[model samples]
Target: MTTRHSHAGTPNPLHSLIEPRALLEIAALPAGLPLLASAERGDGHPVLLLPGFLGDEGSLLALKYFLRNRGYDVQTWGLGRNLGFQTRHANALQQKIRFMHFKSGRKVSLVGWSLGGMFALYGAKAAPECVRNIITLGSPVSMGPEGSQSPPLVKAIYRLIAHPLGTHGHLAQPKARDLREQKRMPIPMSCLYSLSDGVVPPQEATIDGDPALHENIRVPGSHLGLAFNAVVLNIVADRLAQPEGDWHPYEPTGLTGRLYRLLTHKSLPL
Candidate 1:
């Protein structure tokens, strides 16, 4: 007898666990925070951070603080809101990249979460010479029916809230062309996904094409927790610590890697 795995409309179990946690995290996040006062002070290359869906620059404050404290020139989009996909957001991102390059006089690194990740990939594809490395957290780069593991109620709410905004105004549906084009671009890219993510499924985070240029790191945490989880933070720090032209695959070592492997084994098949 043979068992067949299905990737149809079935919801991911890990994603199922992430919904309530993400809601709680979002509610607890403080609003109207200030931008990095001295974004240009860090020693290494500059890093541009993008937030997930329905998330503004304020949502990434914790991650920004963490990187800043670690001595990185981190900057936020400073865009008013994260309503969805709009020409204005894209243009702002492009401008930010150009400004960073001009000011730093070096290729910048981009760390985007969810929708922000997609934007970062596009930015790299459009201008490969400007980006040094790219990192995405729980981004849905693969376009499929089961790309997202969000609960039905949550999905319903997103559709209800975002549908009226129209396709152009709202976050456009994931496209295979975008993923294909992104893969063709030559950039050091790392995708960090959690098996327990409640939003985007782990499989959607996998990149096809060259394994050397792309790496997939599996972390133990919920989708919301990934944005500020200690384990994820260490992984981000390790990745950012590397010098340009010296990218290496992330291998979690010692106790943390072992513990993460043990806890997330049921959800991720290595």
Candidate 2:
């Protein structure tokens, strides 16, 4: 179902402002390389991280580092680049989860960003026995056709790219059957979204399932920032620390939470 915008609409100011900033932030990411250089490994349950569109395992390096230091067996989807929604993509990730389960003899936790989050959710539904918990950063799981809030120019470019590659190619539209399948299964989930996200509209990022099974945490940052933002890192750390069947929703507390709350007012959809 598509979310209807307010009819008394002028263009959404936040949407206009954020799109360019998201591009700028992405370009400047190289400067933060040193901060994520130190990788840490942890014990207990294994955690796998999935990066956003056009992202690779390296995009999640900072989050991996922080989770490792806090104590979790963190790893990346050794997949080279994120192309878009495709059947083969799911197969590749399912293989990874199966391997981890076999080797560790324990269920793993999944943390994914943007497109990666959708894949993680898909993986969980396909093999729920292998996943203990699922967390997503600015993933558009609920939004249907009109949910993509990209600029017309960007949308046009993606359409052009998808045409040559075929619908299941680089920019294929999400399959309705897949979405319907996902909605049928409600895994323990947490969706972390940003009011300041420049990519997806906040509402699109939310999970429309039972509140008890799914929780939404709102933060202040850009879409790219969620991967490395200290505030987001703390929330992830707190959630992963809980034991299975005793999972609790994250309520951002302390100085960082306060700071984030003070700086932002808009909440993104999980």
Candidate 3:
């Protein structure tokens, strides 16, 4: 079994407050170091990005611009704010994927963040033929309740918003839990997690299955800032550029390689 870094019992309540700090960090991007990748560029494939709960397309602007600059044709989940779940949202998303696949005549890659990550899993399950790969950032696809880390106040807000939207039934589905039992996804999958994630527990973010096609990348940052994290961005670019149907585990090199081994608490995949 792959070793996962997780809080032993309940997570610290204070961690939830730390989420806003990630936004502040992102606000400082203009003054921060620009990411210059030493890896291969994308082949101009189509990539779809999904935002987390309470987030919209604007939330992923930085990541979207970065990928666009790197050569991949990126599209945002044009749907409005991600409240929680709804069958209609899923249906519309499937249509979007199929349309892209049809137009490009190529399998589209799904990159979902947080709750959006859960959407990506369902998307891949629903349209494996149209999806080349699925990547999730800090999504609680495994440890639903445990990983959610939703305090009483937060839970209340979710209920109030989800009830009127009639998304509770859809969100109630146990498909995410079912993902854990599967040996592997029909499409290639990547799970990127942050050990210090405040919204979701890190350990429960990824699923354990076929090592060859399934990869768990441990990045360092808040779950909210994953889309803008330099390390995470580099990893995304590298994974997206891989030759389709010819997959391999990511092997970080140079200073990044050293950081991976030092911060990640497990035997190196190599």
Per-residue C-alpha lDDT of model 3 across residues 209-266, encoded as one tens digit per residue: 6677887788777878888776677778878888899977777777656655666654
> Quick one: best TM-score, which candidate?
3
Over 4 Å off, model 1: 1-10, 13-18, 22-43, 145-150, 165-180, 265-270
What lDDT does the true structure give each of the candidates?
0.66, 0.68, 0.75
Off by over 4 Å in 3: 1-8, 31-34, 37-39, 144-148, 164-171, 174-183, 259-270
TM-scores for all candidates?
0.79, 0.79, 0.86
Put down candidate 1 lDDT per residue, 33-95, tens digits, no spaces: 212221123456788998887888788988898788878889988885566555567767788
Error of 2 at 43 (Å): 5.6
On a 0 to 100 scale, what is the lDDT of residue 43 in model 2? 49
Give stretches of model 2 more than 4 Å off: 1-43, 145-147, 160-176, 265-270
Q: Cα lDDT for residue 91, model 3?
A: 75
Q: How are the candidates ranked when ordered by lDDT, highest leading? A: 3, 2, 1
**How many angstroms is residue 130 displaced in model 2 relative to the true structure, after the best TM-score fit?**
0.5
